[model samples]
Target: MNCRTSLSSWQALTTSSERLKKQHLKTLFDSDSGRFDKFSRHIPGVLFDFSKQLIDDSTFEQLVSLAKESDLAAWRDKMFAGEKINFTEDRAVLHVALRNRANTPILVDGTNVTEQVQSELEKMKGFSERVRSGEWQGYTGKSVKDVVAIGVGGSNLGPQMVTEALSAYADNTLNVHYVSNVDGVQLAQVLKKVEAETTLFVISSKTFTTSETMNNARSSVNWFLESAQDKSAIAKHFVAVSTNLEKTREFGIADENVFTMWDWVGGRFSLWSAIGLPIALYLGYDKFVEVLEGAFEVDEHFKTAEFEQNVPLIMALLSVWNTSFLGHTSQAILPYDQALHMLPAYLQQGEMESNGKHVTFDGQTVPYTTVPIIWGMTGINGQHAFYQCLHQGNVIVPADFIASVEPQVALGKHHDVLLSNFLAQTEAMMAGVNEEQVRNDLQSKGKSEEEINELVAHKIHKGNRPTTSIVLDKVDAKAVGRLIAMYEHKIFCQGIILSVCSFDQWGVELGKGLANNIEAELTEENVAYEHDSSTAGLIAYYKQKRNK
Candidate 1:
């Protein structure tokens, strides 16, 4: 389970990959006329075309065998049954329960958690309705006009991405802003756009103690009181989505204004929980429920569909085959729609935070690569920025090309142009230009023999890059929901297949703890402590320069 053992296991799979690589995609397509029919999966309104990936019938059968050997079905059942599969945190990974529309009985510690989830959702609906309908007024007797969501990491990313993706469905009655960075610039720009009397701040943190969020909350409170001149007005303008009722009350938010966040829900997967209050307030409660229903559909598909037909499962298996078995170290998420600009960042956190582990479930080091480095931009933007590297770079990076069959905003010929580029990129990547084609094209362009030789050498593309294209019917609230759920379940399956706990993120804690200690050292004026030479010299230099 150590690094050496993991590397060896991964190395063993390369021989099979090399053999498969020798068989060109053109040959495979010619051999199987129904390649697309055999490789594509249709789930509701989503079409997943994985035919362009570097995979065949034998490769897929082997992946299914790996899933069975890893006991994926049992682990999946344990997760849905409310067992504490996140052993490190000793909590059940039950984000699925948040979208349980069936009201099925799910228990944690002998208490029916399904009831609790339903109750909280009803509460959110009531609150969101009142606020969005102009019934919830500020202390100055004006309806709220703006909502500012304050949270960091998962608390911030998921809702932000969803809201941005489904912006077309937004009611436009109220504007929504999000602040997650500790930097002053983010809050300063947002604060300048709204007045204290009509703005509502939803402070979201599980513990109500995140340093950046609390700091921004304090600064906002100070700015509000300066204008309203009544400290108690904080209760009217600020609400909290947290479990710490004591801290919420102390911060001048009423008990009724404080929503609840359970320990079983993780931040990244919490948009379906109370963390989605901003999303509901911006896009009405009914649209938000549609989002939940969309995800529930994906959840049902994941639970009941066969492995070969399941979209999330197949996506996960493809990722494993590429990263762990084929030695690809990076993955690209290329969304062709411009509205989904933040999706790459959202998936980056979802995948890396969940599966970026070196150890396994039995407290042993893993004997294979865990997670690939996830990075990308919007499809059209990336075509100009990094697609050059993907097409011609030394390392082969697997990519996901996402686009919609119907454009969200259709102008004159713009959507067609965008769709054409989306289709062309994948086709070009799969069937790259060969030497013969390059030479023939150069000759047709009237180039001399010497010029043809030089240009053909540079222009010949070593095709065979692997890519999967996801086509949604449209970019509505429902489609965005299905898209997000697809990737969420994909990360979950990859973690289970790799024999690692995907819910816990202890790696992020170490850095936060170190920052706290460093803050104390930096602020102390008369600090007399033993330090390493490098640290001591840096501190002395800063202090001396500041005194001048």
Candidate 2:
């Protein structure tokens, strides 16, 4: 057994798991009238209710002990202090420094990164203001009406998720389009909507060399040059959020138009940096500032709140309890608000990419499951789609149900109806109908005993599926920032508890390197690399068919 599993808290939780497996959440609620009050917490704009999670007071205390034994607080302090905690890369994990609204000086390599973040924020403000106010012009001297954000993975997911979440607040100042897949169809479809002469492209790649991002950037520039008919015009239309100024210069973007990125900020956690330029462009810079402020609030709470009361830490502990102790292998992200429809996809990348490793920080294979298979959709759509599996399927998936108290659009009773479903689903999942309850209901409805018996098994839902409920004030810019920040901190704490290095994604890098080598084999003649027989046969068939 590893050191983590050997901890007193870990052993206690493991010993208690068998009892927890048989205990019903409905029974827990029935025994404690104040269960919700004891289990739920509230911050400024959000209410985090973990009352439905499959745990008792003793279990909760044990989970908190696990966090303490794991040294979560020390790790969090090291990250905030800009120490090189991402030891594999020898870089500091300092996404929190990007939203240091209090302007506290955080140094990395003897230079204050907090000041650097502020400088970049100011630059984003100035540039986004210019674009939104019609001061920034394209090659044709016309104000940019559309913004095309090109990038993949972190660059694409974070900004696009935020923009889509707060899209109702967009002022129609600019229509932002995202092209992440190098599949050509996405970019082709986006390009068809706007004239090249009036559109601005913001290409985001840390090195200006990511394959999908660069390919999409090159194709966009080609389309722009076809219309502008001048190589110099590229400077007026294209901007970049990257550190590689030489590559941006060669690609025809001016030095001033190239924003900055730092090594300390991992791409999955980089939206607070200049990676959020497209967010600022789509929704004015002030709204962007609100996003930062919202995140800063959670950062302060995570830094100061007690472990039992801290929402993010509790989130991490619940996840650990569910996956590591209880043996639940997957969790669902079900948002009742339509504005947060992309939240599942965003978090899938955030959580899975960060903690989807089998090895611990010391390279020991972990005995426990590290991260859950994170998946889900917007609540209404998922109700029709996969809630069947969630409700009746044997695999008991824990879920987070998110909804806002107020709707962004506010049309009549839509918000109430939406919230009603959100409230009812969690209740139904907790207090599922037994065979007796189903039979009683069918008999009350005047169904024959035979009919009731036939339908009873089909309709019977064995409840006790665990879920957490998060209620936001509204799905505005600041709330979106808070929601995402909460999850980000949860992922960080989870990695610490699980003994995995969340900051380094060596898995993603390996696949990227492999794809780069394979690209040459596909495009260049007489350039074949050895592969397994299956892969070799597939490639040979593709090349043979293409030649014909």
Highest lDDT against the true fold, candidate: 2
Q: Please report, in order, the local distance difference test score of every candidate based on alpha carbons.
A: 0.88, 0.93
The 10 consecutive residues of candidate 1 with the worst lDDT sum are 1-10
lDDT of 2 by residue, 396-507 (tens): 9999999998889979998888888999999999999999999999999999999997999999999999999999998988898899999999999999999999988989
Candidate 2 vs. true structure, TM-score: 0.99
Candidate 2 to native Cα RMSD, angstroms: 0.9
TM-score between candidate 1 and the true structure? 0.96
Task: Point to the candidate with the largest TM-score.
Answer: 2
lDDT of 1: 0.88
Model 1 lDDT, residue 127, Cα: 89
What are the models' TM-scores?
0.96, 0.99
Model 1 lDDT at residue 454: 74
